[model samples]
Target: MSPRPFDHVVGKNLTSVKFPVVAGLPGPEGLKTHLRGHLLRMSNVGALRVLVTGATGYIGGRLVPRLLEAGHQVRVLVRDPAKIRSVPWADGVEIARGDLTDAASLREPFRDIDVVYYLVHSMNSDGDFEEAERRSAENVASAARDAAVGRIVYLGGLHEHSDRLSTHLRSRTQVGEILIDSGVPTMVLQAGVVIGAGSASFEMIRHLTNRLPVMTTPRWVNNHIQPIAVGDVLHYLAAAATAATSESRTYDIGGPDVLRYGEMMQIYAEVAGLARRRILVLPVLTPKLAGMWIGLVTPVPLSIGRALIESLSTDAVAYEHDIDAIIAAPSGGLTPYRDAVALALRNAENTEAGWDGAAADPLPTDPAWTGEIVYTESRDAVVRADPQRVWEALLHWSSRHGHWTVENKQEPTLLELHGPGRARLQWRIESVTPARTRLHQHASYIPKGLPGQLYWLGLKPLHRIGLRRAMQSVIKESEGRR
Candidate 1:
């Protein structure tokens, strides 16, 4: 069979357009004509002034870079602008502070925006999240319509239409319907489990597989699901920004492979290089019971776990492939499930590395007049070595020392080293005896403002753990040297 035309190459810029030979027209001339038509359609669409909600979320955070690469003028609507300060594309795009539930805050951000990507959802919120989501969607749709926004693209869950729809899936579908009914040209791309680093579903899978070698799951494990890569989802989302489509369209999107939940776990185990896990499916475990178990084993909260577990009871395979005729398939074709898992794992590793590196970097030195010290943590250890030996150990304890705490991986900052009795900058040492040295460590931060205080309090636990680890490492190294 002939390969499909315009297969997308994964992990590259979207500029690579290919045209294959058609059956009816004459050879190269036919291909050239088709290519010209495709280019003309693309030109007619042009670049859009796009507004993205939920810019700090896993999918939205990643999507911003892709939209920027495609040369679109991007504006991000975020509740807190500081949340996106570290984002790589934060500086390149316009940012407006707004909340979807607050209709007053939405109008300014939606003004003159050609396309609005409605990515916000209240899945993790406490109490009546479904109602909250509906209200927020209503506000967004109304705001976009009032501002004359051309289109709205939404990401929703894939589920078969039925009265027994889970609350999560029901809310997703309802939000899409609300947007469509609001008279905006809305495109809803429905997907099942999104396999990507930092995605809630993928994280749950990762933790469950990594932590449990012997698993006993409910009957939902047998339900069929099609997990799509976050990359492909992003591709479709970016394409929807300009792809010609019906006024209000709903597309079910998934990866090439469909597997049962149990099969997905097995594949994840394989990709993660874990030993083959044994599974026992019991028919009696309720969603609440399963959620409690998941909450106990994984970092996911009970609310989210229950919601996700409820949705897993139904099959989520796509019923249509019409999206391919509109938006081109990924360059290298759709990512296989295993390949998607692998990519997610690689991204996770890179993210962890970045986090560790950030933790190890020196903290900003605040001037004394900034404010009063808002946070301080201290630790002390006595080493059975001379002062000189302890000093030497301190001098050499860089990030490579690997003695930092398991949680934050924080390395000490040396501010001062005077003779054998004094060392400073979060650490100080004094020789109590010729063969015994007393080491004291303290992390002190003066509040630059309210944000500084919040930052210090937020990381207090990690800071404490890091201080303890630093003192212990110094003691061990000094004692060994003696």
Candidate 2:
């Protein structure tokens, strides 16, 4: 661990400066804000202007908000400014229109920027995502070198400590090399499945576990991985901007638990309070057939589904336990996969609960119910503002004082956090008009016998009523906000 550079933000040589302890702040958010101020003060004195690329992507989207909150004047490199308008702080960011493939466009974004966060990847992109990712890395590295950027922060994938790497993971490693070869100090953080809302991997797990009752288990499901929370990943990214002494080094970032995907599904089921399905695994299942099965069952696209499923055979846990030396020190304690999933679901649920009004009613309940034991929740709020304003509140509502509750097998106490309506089990959100928001309740409990099925069937109508009442409460709350 490195010393907290209380004054290093002002351009004092970090190696020589003695760090002072920071005064007490409320929490991580507060500490980040203070750090941002420190960094800005340094920038004013000619330290380094920072540039964040891939602002439109998932991790990048979350990272930008933290950066802006920290008081860093961030310039986000994006291909289309319009794609960013829906972003919460769209107006706040200094949007630089530059695609990685276009070298001419990269010059403006790299110009005079002290630190650049290289976050773009093509694994999710259409055919030849690997080649595209490599090319993009090359273009950015060349432009950054030409512009004399001091350091580059990159996030890549973690794989087994072997020469045989999955195409996806291999390209990620290559991308780091391209940036390092460009003469800039580069700190690479390699991570496995990032567990959180809107994360492709997490969502896949969520949908799969929730929708399947009896699944033809793939051998990949038995493979082990150390999953990290999205929040943790962000902390590392922020810390990496200034933590590393060696610019050309890599760090292995993972969660506290090394869990099998099968175990993960069982945890999810338990936490969500759904009945644990009996999983039957067959060793004969090939990655190709398994991927097609996933495509048939889960919402994951065929391309990524194929790539990810194939990589499961290779252990993605920490490679050399010593890689932490390069990346920034770990911030708070690591969140478990079950807890992370609960938080993510709650975040998404809370957001969904905010979309109330006439037009959004009866909101696509079955839009995508391909998962097992599907827990579909909808809530609506009718505010004086149009759909846009209601949607805004939904998207950015969680960070504030109002907390959302999600059950976790590891932490049963979280169930109490949902309040009385949630005791019934299930979530709902509805909006009759722009001015009204509704929270819906839809709960399905564990089945024990004929009595259990009868009891659940009998209560099905009541669940609908409960859902409507929950929606009503949400609407009232939204109204109170004004």
Model 2, C-alpha of 379: deviation from truth (Å) = 14
Tens-place lDDT digits, model 1, residues 1-482: 11112222222333343333323335545434433443333334456679999887667877787889888889999888987777667789999999988999998999877789988876664788888899999999878766656678999999987888888899999999998876556899999998866667776787677667898999999999999998899899989887765357689999999999999999988986677878899999987799889989766777778888988989999989888888889899998999888876653222112322221111112112111223556677777888778767776664444433223222332323221111123556678888987887765554332344466679778867866776777788888942
Q: List the residue pairs that clash in candidate 1.
A: 8-330, 8-331, 8-332, 9-331, 9-332
- Give residue 475's error in model 1 in angstroms: 8.6
Q: For candidate 1, what is the lDDT? A: 0.72
Q: List TM-score per model, in order.
A: 0.68, 0.68
| Highest lDDT model number | 1
lDDT of each: 0.72, 0.63
Model 2: lDDT equals: 0.63
For candidate 1, what's the RMSD?
Answer: 13.1
